[model samples]
Target: MEHDVPSLPEEIIVKILLRLPTKSLLKFRCVSKSWLFLISSYDFAKAHLKNSNDDRLMFGSKGFSMDLYTWSPQSAADHSAFGGTIYPPLDQNLLVQRVCIDCPLYEPHDVVWFEGSCNGLICLSSSDESLSLWNPTIGKAKKLPNSGTVLDFDYYGIGYGFGYDELIDDYKMVESLSFEPFAGAPTLDIQLKVYSLRANSWKTLLNWPGGHAFGGSGKFLNGAIYWSVHRLDGPIEWVIVSHDLSTYTFSVVHLPHLHNEDNDDVNVDVKVLRGCLEICCERNTHMDIW
Candidate 1:
């Protein structure tokens, strides 16, 4: 027979659950069907994440798989790495990704982990291998069913864009894959896909013209996600691609004129600072900020 305690009010129960550690709450999900559904809701996820007191540090695995891991660092007393730094006590949550080598298409350093964060949630993906969203604070995670398509590393490039749509209260991810499939074919074939967390599904988005978005440089600001794209459509150019979350539309944000013709290779990185978008350009020997 199941031993039952005195019934507690649902509000009281929720308040108590809020105080419990994420591991305990996750285990309690199996106690009842209603509790499982409640714990799985995105609204509750936001609440739990906001209520959490833990801070996280993410590191990449050295193994062949190149998976991701998040852990709370211990103090100087318990760890030697923090010997000189001062830190307040922090809650500990160690969430490690299981690894089995599959030889990723790109180098381990090329993986997209610190791509972006929205309301304490992070999107992680690598060269079409796998994509997932994780909440490090509460130790909850949801892996997308598919990561779309990937091409050979020698002829492929990918970029990830992650942000929230406040109008719909939804979190979204954009995956842009550019590749050259055949020897005589065009150098760039761009395939785009977007995932909506609230809908719990992935959908194909309209393709941008011939170009490749630089992986791991997505910047979110003013309700749009932006990436630095190297254009291959007609005249070669390097520009920023911004995807508006609310409309699912795409547009180009051209860089300011930096008069130079001899600079063969240019690098552009996008960032958001002080409530505005900032672009940095590197051409051969000099760097420009705009």
Candidate 2:
């Protein structure tokens, strides 16, 4: 008896493989040397990750390290719950990509892990001293420069986003820098900065009224980056600081009501949760809403 062998084009097979999750794709490497090469290619990796919008948020603590968790809206009782028992380790391959692309600035603990995430990027700070941005998926990072001459400032905010300019074809990183110069200062210095990946530098933008910090890791939506800012009158405000990736201009938008009754209860710690920007007021409770 004779058997017929099915035939498929290599391009088709590659596309099908790309659709698989990273774990499944990694397992297929043993199929052949050619297969391994294709899976490991930069283009292939990028395509795979870009398409896999898992929309899951992972959380980590200092002692517990990092654990992957999924937000289940269906489970209204527990919005944040562990999706699976097995937690994957941090992707070093992605980290290398971040370092190469300069997605987030990584200094000695300057990029200390923070809860905020934006456009697959995570917002990090340097041990209460500095600011940095990171794209976790690609492992790219860009560190923001210190704003004031004094390093003793108490609060800092950082945001990242991409936009288009009519004149240019590429996207740019819209970064906003907000800080309060210690407690005794009468006024807070509100400054916005734009970092052009193409130029590989920072440019100062217009100053805004009132004090604002980029809420959590900023959420990049509709070509704008959204962050929560605090007003002096004790009201938490939501502001959208938009950056035109192409032209590289900064603009601000006002959001709905955001406030905390207790002076000590402020929900300024923002992060990208489940692909949307969210803020958590109570650290132990981990309340996040996008």
Tens digits of lDDT, candidate 2, 126-208: 45555566655445566656543343468755444443332543334555555676776554566666655456566766644
**Best TM-score among the predictions, by candidate number:** 1
Q: TM-scores of all models?
A: 0.61, 0.55
lDDT of 1 by residue, 120-190 (tens): 67666654477777766455567777755645656777767788998998898887777777765656677
Considering summed lDDT, which 10 consecutive residues are worst modelled in model 2? 92-101
After aligning candidate 1 to the native by TM-score, how far in Å is the CA of 264 from where it should be?
Answer: 5.0
Clashes of each: 0, 24
The candidate scoring highest on lDDT is: 1
Error of 1 at 85 (Å): 16
Candidate 1 wrongly placed segments (more than 4 Å): 1-112, 126-128, 150-154, 184-186, 207-216, 259-264
Number of residue pairs clashing in candidate 2, backbone atoms closer than 3 angstroms, sequence gap of 3 or more or interchain: 24
